[model samples]
Target: MNSHKQLFILSCLSLVLVLLSGQFGLQVEAGHHIHHRSKKLFVFGDSYVDTGNTNKSKPGSWKEPYGITSPGKPTGRFSDGRVLTDFIAKYLRLRTPITHRLWDYTVPKHSLKYGMNFAYGGTGVFDTSSSGPNMTAQIDIFNQLVQENVYTLSDITNSIAYVSVAGNDYNYYLATNGSLPGFPSFIASVVNQTTINLIHLQSLGFKRIVVGALQPLGCLPQATAQTSFQSCNSTFNDLVTLHNNLLNRSVTKLNQEINDHNTFTILDIFDGFRTVLNNPSSHNIKERLKPCCFGVSSEYNCGSVDENNVKKYLVCENPESTFFWDELHPTQAGWNAVYNELEKRGLYKILY
Candidate 1:
C-alpha cells in the first residue's frame, strides 16, 4: 500500500466502507483432489475482497478494532478478522493472494504463489464519490501486469477469478440522490457493466469466474439502524433482488453465448446472508443486523475518536457472537458462517 496519505477515498468512506486464508505450496491431506488445474486465484472487487489493496494511510480500514479479531491490528481488511477472499483461497488449497498494492520489503523475488488481489475498499463497477479505482481500472492494472509478463498466459487460463460487487454502486446512487423511480434502470446498468467486466476477463483467458450476488442492503446495519437493529428495510432489499436477478440472467446468458456452462457463476451471497439473518441461532450470532462496533452517536462510527484521541465508537464484547462488524461489512465469523452456508446450498463449485 502507498504511504502518500493513502488515496481511494469514498463518500462517507468510514460510515459505509462497503464490502458491502491458507499456507503456501504444501498440499493438505484434507483435500480430496486439486491436481487437474492451476491453483492460482485472482480476486477483484470492493472492500468485501480487498486485502489491503487500498492505501495504508486511509483511516477507516487502517484504524483500530478493524482487524482486532485475527491480526490484533488493522491490516487493511474491513472486517475484524478475515474477509471472503481468505476463505475462498483456503477452499482452493491456495494461500491468500498478496495485495496488488502491497510491496513487502522481505518478499522473495521468486514471484507470488497465488495470482494477485486487485480489489480496493469502497470501490465498485463504476466510479463513485469514493474516488477510487473502479472495476475497469482494476482490470486495467491486471492487464498491465500481464503485459509485463509478471504472470504468464498459462497462469491467466488456469486461475480462478473471484469478484465481489457489494452495494457500493447503489450506495453511490443513493448518496448522490438518484431518483427512486429510475433506480431500477441504474441497477440494470450496473449489472451490464459488471457483465462486460466478466467478458473482459474471459477474453483474458480465465476459465472459471465466481461473482457474488448483491447482498441484502436493507439488512446491513446501516439501514437497520433506523429500526434500532430489530428489522431490515424491505424496500432496499427489493432493489437488491432486482440487481441479483439481472446479474444472474446476464451471467447465464454470457455462459450460453460462449457455450461454456461453467465459465461464469454467482456465489449466492444474498442467500447466505439471509440464511444467517433468518436463523441467527444456527450461526451462533446473537444479533443479526446490529453491528458489533459502532459510534456512540450518529456522528461517530466503528473507529472514531475525539480531539484528545479518545475513542468515540463502541465495540462489542466478542465480535464472533455478533453478525455485522460494521455498518457495511460482516465480522470474520459472519463471513465464515456465510461461506459455510453457501457451501451447504451447493450454489456452485470452484477450482473443480
Candidate 2:
C-alpha cells in the first residue's frame, strides 16, 4: 500500500475510537448525575418512598411481595422493590438511609454517618386515617436528635432534606366528610402547614431542602380501575393543580426569605409524573397510570396473600412498562424516571 493511503486508514480508525469513547463518557456522566452529589438525603413522608419505617408487626410493609423485585422478599418499603429515597440516595452516592423506626434496635454508629430517614409511610402533614406520625411530629424527631447531638449542626448543614406529602391528608379529609365546598379551605390549611415545615427545616440549617409537590392522585390505579384504567379523571387532577399552585407559591416565598442562601427547592413530582404519563413511549413506559401490582378487588392490596402463600394483588405482566408500583406508589424504575426529570430541570442545584 502507498504510504499516504496507510496513514489515511490509521486516521479513520482513530476517529472511530474517539467516537466510541465519547459515547461511553456520556453514559458515565448520566450515571454520575444520580451518584455524585455531596449532600446526603434525609427522607420524609408517605409510602411513595418509605423504607420500612412503618411498624412491622401489623402486616404493614414487612410482608410478601413488598420487596420481591429487589430483595426477593418483603422489606418495610411500600413497593415491590426500592422506592424513591433509594434512587435519590443512589444519585447522591449514599446508601439508602435507615428508617427511624428500625434504627432503635439496629446499628447506631452508622445512623449519623449518612443522616437518618424520618419519613413514615401512610402519614401526612396532618393526622390521617393511618396512625403514623404526622410531618410535624417527624420534624420534631429530627429536631430532638439534633438537640441530643446525635446529629450536629455541621451534619445538618451538609445534609439535604427530602419531604414528600403524597395526598394522605386529602384522603383523610375525604374520609371524614370533607366535601368539595370545604376542600379549598382544607387544602389551603394543608399547604400552609407544609410551608411551615419546609421553612423550619431551613431554619434548622439543612443546605438544601426539597419538598415534593403532590402527584396525580386521581390517576392512581385505585382511582383509574373504576374507569377501566383507560383514562385519568380530570376532576381529581384539577384538585392536584390547586395543591401544586399553592405549594409553588409557598416555596417561592420561602426561597425569597432565604435569598442569601437559596436553600429551598421544589421537587415538582407533579409535573415530572405528568411528563412520563403524557409521553410514556418516549420514556419506555407503556402503561403510565396502571399499577404493576394491584389487589384482586378493592378490599385487598399489594401485600395481601391467600391461604397458599399466593399473592392476592394482580401484578402487571411487566413492571418496567408501568409507572405505578401499586395503587398508591411508583415502582423503583418509575421513581428513577421522576428523579431524572427533576435533575434535568435543575431542581437538585443546591446553593450555599
Candidate 3:
C-alpha cells in the first residue's frame, strides 16, 4: 500500500475508536443516573402515608381489613392494603422502609438503606384526633436520628422526603366545634407550618422533598355518609380547595427562594383525587363515595367486631372496585390509581 493511503486508514480507525468510547461513556453515565435515582425515602405526615407508624393497639389501622388487600392482614397502614409510601417506594425501586417506630436499637444497621417512615395515622402538621406524633414531632424524631448518626449526610442527600398532611387537623377542628369563620385561618396555619416543615427537611439534607396537597375532605365517606353516599358536600370541598391553593402557593414560593426548581415539589393530591372521583371509570373505580368497608350503624367502622365477636362492619366482596376502604382512607387500588395519575404527571422528576 502507498504510505499516504496507510496513514489515512490508521486515522480512520482511531476516529472510530474514539466514537465508540464516547458512546460507551454516555451509556455508563445514563446507567449510573438510573441506578442512583433515589437511595432512600424519608416519609412524614399523616394516615395517607403512615405505613405502620401508629401504635398497634391505638389506631384501627392495626386492626383487621386494613392490609387485607396486600399483606393479607393488618400492618398498621390505614387502608385495605398499601398506601402512598408503598407506591412511592415501588416507583423508586426501593423496599418500603420500615416505620420509624420499628427502628429499634436491635435492628441490623444495614436496614436503614431504605430510609424510614415517620408518618402517624390520623395525625397532621399539628396534633389531631389521634395521639400519634404530629408532623413537627415526626421531623424532630428525624432530626434526632440525624444527630445520633442513624443516617449519614450522604444518605439524606441521596434520599427523598415524602410529606402527606391529609386534612386530619381540619377534621379535628370541625369535630371540636371550631368556628366556621376561623376555618380559613386554620387552613393558613396548617400550610404555613407545613412550609416550615418542608424547609426544615431541606435543611436536614434531603435533596428532594414531595409535599402532598390535601385531598377532597368533603368527598370522604365520613362527609358523604350524610347524603347516603350519593353526593359530596361542596361546602367542605371548598375548604379543601382553599387549603390546597394556599399550599400550592407556599410550595411555589419555597422553590423560588431556594432557586432549585426541583428541590421541592407538590404531589397535588387534591387534583389527583378530584380527577379520580369525577371520572371513576377511567381509574376503574366503581364506587367513589361509598366505602368498601363500613359500620352497619353510626357507632362502628370497618373491622369493628361486636362484643360477642359478631362483625359490626361489613366489607365489600371486591375491595379493588371501591375507592375507599373505610370512612377516611382509600382502598389499595384507589391509591394505586392516584399514584398512576401522579406518575403520568411527572412523578419521575421527584424520584430522579
Candidate 4:
C-alpha cells in the first residue's frame, strides 16, 4: 500500500511541473513582444540632444566636471550626466543610441541596431559659432548610412526621429550682430528653415518624427547670471514664445500636408521646462535658475581649468538638487524631471 501511494504522488508532481512551464512560456513571450514593439530611436539637433558626437578635443562637453553626477566622469554630455536624448530612449525602452562619430573606431558596427545619434553640440539648423555639423549635414550622414544599407528598410520604418533644435539659431543670430528690431523676421526665417528640415526628414521615410520647441531662453543661467540668478529676463522668454508659436504652426501644417497626424509631433519642451521650473518641489529641485557648475569669474565657464591643470569651475555639493548644469544645459536630474513632465503630458502615447 505504501509503494502504491508513492507512485501516485510522483505522477501528480510531474503534471504540476508541466503547468508551471506553460505559464513561464507565456511571460517570456509577452516580454519579447514589448521589446520588439519598442522600435528604434534616431536623434538629431544641438547640445540639448547631443550624446558625445562632437569633437573629442572640444573644450566643453568632453572636459572635466561635465558628467560628475552619474558616470562620475566626463563623457561628452553637456550635463552632469545623461541629456534629453538618453531619457527619451529610456522611455522608448531602447538603448541610448551610439554617437555617430564613434562608429568606425571605438564603437562596433553591429551596435547600429539601436540607431545612431547625429547631434553635435553648439550646432543649429543653419550655421552657428560652434563650427560643427549643422542639421543639414547631420541628415546627410544619416542618408549616407541608409544608402550603404547600414540600416534596413524595416529599421527606418519602425524607428522614431528626435530633433531638438533648441535656441542655438537665435543665439547665433544675436551674437552675429543681427538687428533686434528685425528679430521677428529673423525668427520667421529660422522657423522656415526648420520646417524645411522637418520636410526633409519626412522625405527620408520616417513614419514618426518628434521635434523639441525652443525652451525659455530667459531662464537659462547665462541670461539670469546678470541678475545674480535671482530673476529671468522676460524679453528673451518673449522671443522664445514667438519661436515656439511659429514652430507649432509649422509642425501642424506639416502633419496636415502629409495627411498623417501621427507623422509629426512637436514635443513642447518649452512647456516641459517651464512646468518643472515653476514647480521645483514637485520635481525635487531646490531651484531652477542657478547652475550646478561655473567658473570662478566671467572670463571662464564650466569645465574651465587653469594653466597648471587645476580646476577653475566650482561644482555644487549635490547635482541632483539642481536643475541647470551650466550656462545652457540641464543636469541629469533636471533632464529627468523634464522627461517626467513630458511623459505626464502624454509624450509616450504621442510618440509610440
Candidate 1: regions farther than 4 A off: 1-32, 35-37, 103-106, 347-351
Worst 10 residues of 1 by lDDT: 17-26
Which residue pairs overlap in candidate 1's backbone?
9-130, 10-130, 19-48
What is candidate 3's lDDT per residue for 1-352, written digit by digit as tens? 9999999999998787667656643222332234353379899988899888788878388888778888899899889899999998997778999888889635787778899999988888888878888999999999999999988899899888999989888889988999999999998999999999999999999888998888998999999989999999999989998988998888889889978888888888887888889899998899999999999999988888887978888899999999999999899999988888887787767567
Global lDDT of each model?
Answer: 0.85, 0.79, 0.86, 0.87
For model 4, residues 151-199, the per-residue Cα lDDT tens digits are 8677878889989888888888989898889899999988899888888
* Steric overlap count per candidate: 3, 3, 0, 0
Residues 1-352, model 2: lDDT tens digits: 9999999999998787667556543222343342223355678788886888788875647887677777878888887788888877776667888888766776767665777788878899998877778998999998898898877887788778999989999888988888988898888999999999988888888878888889988888777888888888888889989999998888888877767436777777888888878888876888887788878887788778778977777777777777888888887668778877776877446311
- The 10 consecutive residues of candidate 2 with the worst lDDT sum are 26-35
Shift of residue 273 alpha carbon in model 2, Å:
0.6
The lDDT of model 2 is 0.79
Model 2 regions more than 4 Å off: 1-38, 106-108, 306-310, 350-352
Residue 139 of model 4, lDDT score: 91
Candidate 3 residue pairs that clash: none
Which is the better candidate, 1 or 2, if ranked by lDDT?
1
Runs of candidate 3 exceeding 4 Å displacement:
1-33
